[model samples]
Target chain A: MEITIAHLYPELLNLYGDKGNIATLKWRMEQRGINVTVKEYALEDEIDFDGTDILFIGGGSEKAVRMAANRLCEIKKKFEAYADNDGVVLAVCEGFHLIGTYYKLNGEKIKCAGIIDIFAEYTPDRLIGDVLLQSSAIGSTVVGFENHCGRVEIGCYKPLGKVLYGYGNTDSAQYEGVVHQNIVGTHLHGPLLPKNPKLADYIISRALKKKYGSVTLSEIDDTLELQAHKYMADRYKNCVRKKNDDDI
Target chain B: MTKIRNSLAIVACKLLILAGRLMGKKGSSAPGSIAMKISPGVLRSLASQIKGDIIAVCGTNGKTTTNNMIDSLFSSAGKTVICNNYGANMLPGVACAFISRASITGKLNADCAALECDEASLRHIVKHVTPTKIVVTNLFRDQMDRYGEIESTAALLNEAFEKVPEAMLILNADDPLCAQFGKGRNAVYYGVSEDTGLHGEEAKDGRFCPKCGGELEYEYHHYSQLGKYKCIGCGFERPNPNYSATRVDISDGLKFVLSYKGSQHKLELNYRGFYNIYNIIASFAVYETAGGTIEEAKKVFDDYKPQLGRMETYKVGGKNVILNLAKNPAGFNQAIETVCADKKAKDILIVINDKPSDSTDISWMWDVEFEKLKSANLGRLVVSGLRKYDLGLRFKLCGFEGVVIEDISREALEGIISGNGEVCYILANYTALFETQKILKTMEDK
Candidate 1:
């Protein structure tokens, strides 16, 4: 099977090691004997989202997000159509904030692609730490790091996971990330894939299903991958539990 | 009353130092913290007594090495230099450094004070010691928890710059964000003029022009965001560097020709990597601009070795173990490139600690270009530290094949030392570097 992955605004939205997602996705796909061709779409680069089977957008600084939003607006319709067609999409951190309807920063509303039906606003204090989430989509714990000031409001979209530890969508919200169709947007940025290979495989499998109609991905040895995942998940979980115990 | 207060502060600092020594502790910060508590204005008072210029080096990376280089350059010219060589760059630690060198009457007996100031603490330090010259190495995304973004960090430095308008600014012309600091100011810009063959296709930080908000077109990149760049839309280009490394050859050791005012001087550096080349040139620029001769600066570079945990080499078990500090993405990428540049097979030990000094957030590891290691002949990949698995997973995902050891201890060091590879490269974060160095020292003694 073949898949074309288009990395959107890689230069502008490149922060917090978000490019690791691209590395993880490519490695996992190549390991599965799937042919994968990756293309990069930066500030002025022409993007053909229709031909893209999977799309990845990483995080960046606030100013970078502003710059990326201007360029991303040029291809908003194409990206929305790609998502509507069940194209696998993963947007992380500031990328997640930019995919929403609008991000409110310093009392000014910065309009984005509006690809995901959500609104994110900047908080005075940033939420920064390791995050552990019980993701229902992948049916496993997702471990990653969250560093942002945007508090997202998932209006109608399904959440990717429940916040097992750390601040997720917002300080008050119990969930983390937005999942609409095959699209996923999250603030988790341990590049969001290497530690959680299940989600990487799940996204690849979903993209393959969209192309091949009905197919089950062959499972490879996930021993080392799962061990890494479990290590992080347990560490964050114990940290949260310890905090709760101290509070009591 | 002022003498009595200064005397009390000095005594408190000395007592803390003595206690630290008795406890077998490297009390780099405690004495400073205690001195600040004893006399809040001690840093300013002591700094005011200094007879010569105070040179402050502030940036995310290379602050220590650059500060030490400036210190060595000044000292080699027969000037007595006082510096906080223990990597304590904060305000209190800086205060403690001055207090340690000051007499009981709060008199500083030093020809020059060359100090490294943390980017976040630059504002606080400037309030006390008004440096005659300030060198901003480069601004990269670092310690997101402490500094929200690179722009915010730059804003903080700009705010501090406004306070010290008289201080001469030394900047990196190649860095877009750093180059912006030179705008509307008389700044000495230093950058690599010739391409060093370090450019990569990866997404780089500071790719947009700060002036026009347009995408920057790079003539060629020398690693992340350090490149000759121009904006076609606004016609904003790299400023003409007053002090430039006209040519850099990092084939063996760093060999570069420094150009200033129609005169070029050849300099051979004992340091490795292009980043160190930038550091060396930045220090040379500061020295020359501060009335030092090029001949004196060249002599300093001839014998200049970086401080501990920064490319410090040790021989253990008949293998050369090189320790280099990789605190952030930019620094880590340079260290990785330096290792990969060698064709010989080497056992690599990557240690990552999430200590407060080492940045509690470990997400920056994902930003480093570990995939470059795949092309190198890596023998055994030993990953150690509190976040050893994270580093191991990153290497594994990057398609590097080797025996992965996740434990970081003396035993792990022994295993790496006894490995088949003749050379062992140990890349460590801020805290891990110190720990690894102490372990290596212990093993070397045995």
Candidate 2:
């Protein structure tokens, strides 16, 4: 009857309206007559994995990322075990980089949670634009914005989807995100959920099924959501958008 | 060769401006880029010829308004001033403004130049012209894909200011990201020392101390990261501003008491929105700093009509249509506050364009505290522009029902204006501003 969501580093790792994901999840669940409890964990606070349904970690500044990553390094095993069970974790942009092994900063490696087989390094050529991703995990096209200077390396792991347009995980990888067990990671941050209701529902259903086994979430009116997603996705069909200096 | 290139660039730029004017284009940037392509050192050479001071206004919000205010204050004093007007605040626009004011012989005779400098382009711009006074309005997270992050913008600003060490910085002391630049530098600060209690939950990009990365503590916030704040770890705090505004009031227009040089001056303006208070006070600070008296600044500000889209008013179909440009969350949140302050029944039409100038990523739309708008005093809520559906979806998520999506902006305007004699407030992003303004103007007073 009730779902508890944990937002890790809500204040520090807040960027690009990534907190909208939690808001979207909360609003959707509350509309279904289900009670929702949101647990927020700041820098020095302890995280409770037991009975927590969904976990969200957003992007932050380089310093915040370094500081948060170092703080969470000690308890990374708890995160791995949490995911190994049916607990859902959603990480975006710098959060996606946080679950990785290490973040290379100017030839110096800063250790992260190291729960996933992913690594990221700083790049001068920043990948930034409105991106469209065809995600098989949610069985729909995901549309959002990707702005990052870190080119990720997903070593020997299946990606969430192939990049339909814009830069993805790596230029050669042509992939967008990492999907392992109940963990979902992506850099598409239009906050990555309000526009793509199916994916938001997907993350919710997984959490619900884990708690109240084989539960089906009722359908809400998503015409506006799908309209927003398809509008941005269809714009990228024949065109690859890049930021041009002269365009400004 | 330098003289010849200057002559060619100047004449060609003038010819292009004339042609653009003939074609009904309010051209500002394109001709400047063409001139820069011809003469690379044009901005520096022209800027050096200014008889008075070259003041550059840089920040996320209030750049255009502050720069324009400075322009009006100096020009009203009968000084030959050259400014990049109409929100053209990049390197090329600065070049074009100088070229527009240049003589046919490729020499300038301006007494002063008020240039609005874009934050990301400041480093490259400083390579050309060193401003005599640099006014940083405030820092905010704008165009995430373009600026990358707020910290990167602070770094870019630092790199530029380092190049022009002699240029005195007029900073917003209340902003932790901005005031950090004044440390150990020949700079003065200006801010609203009194808490106006007007606050929004927009992205506070300056939450951490720029000095030591320690989390900052706030006594109260006037708005997004701007107010009385101090770092917990480092002793760095909001410096007592050399010029500050206190006793703020925005109930009807703006009224505040300005404090500077150990004297208190009462200041009032016919402007809405709490954010414009910063623009007015910052302009007054710059005006006084550049050797102008307070009386002249106040005289000009009292009679000042805001530049297009800064609460511009039009009457169509017997409805007052107010058009303002709200690009980012902080700006949008303030605009929403203005609308919510009005007790009169009003219909709100939001046009969100995803043009590259608007930074194709419209994700920031969700960041605007749209829920603050009281549904009680609201009429039909319509969404338009290229990214209308996206904003509409954001509304849908907020549990708003009966949302209208009219792609054609003109009809949206007409639709809102025709309804039940409600005051219509048309808000648009970058590219949609001009179009909405033009359509509103055509539909006005027929």
Candidate 2, superposed: residue stretches over 4 Å from native: A241-248
Give me the TM-scores for chain A across all models, comma-separated. Answer: 0.94, 0.95
- TM per candidate comes to 0.94, 0.97
Pairs in steric clash, model 1: none
Off by over 4 Å in 1: A241-248, B1-4
Give per-residue CA lDDT, model 1, range B165-187, as digits (tens). 98889999988888888878878
Model 1 C-alpha RMSD to native: 3.0
Candidate 2 per-residue C-alpha lDDT over B267-361 given as tens digits, one digit per residue, 9 for 90 to 100:
87889988887888788788898788888988998999998998998988777889999998888888988888877888888898888788677
lDDT of 2: 0.85
RMSD after Cα superposition, model 2: 1.6
In candidate 2, position B314 carries an lDDT of 92
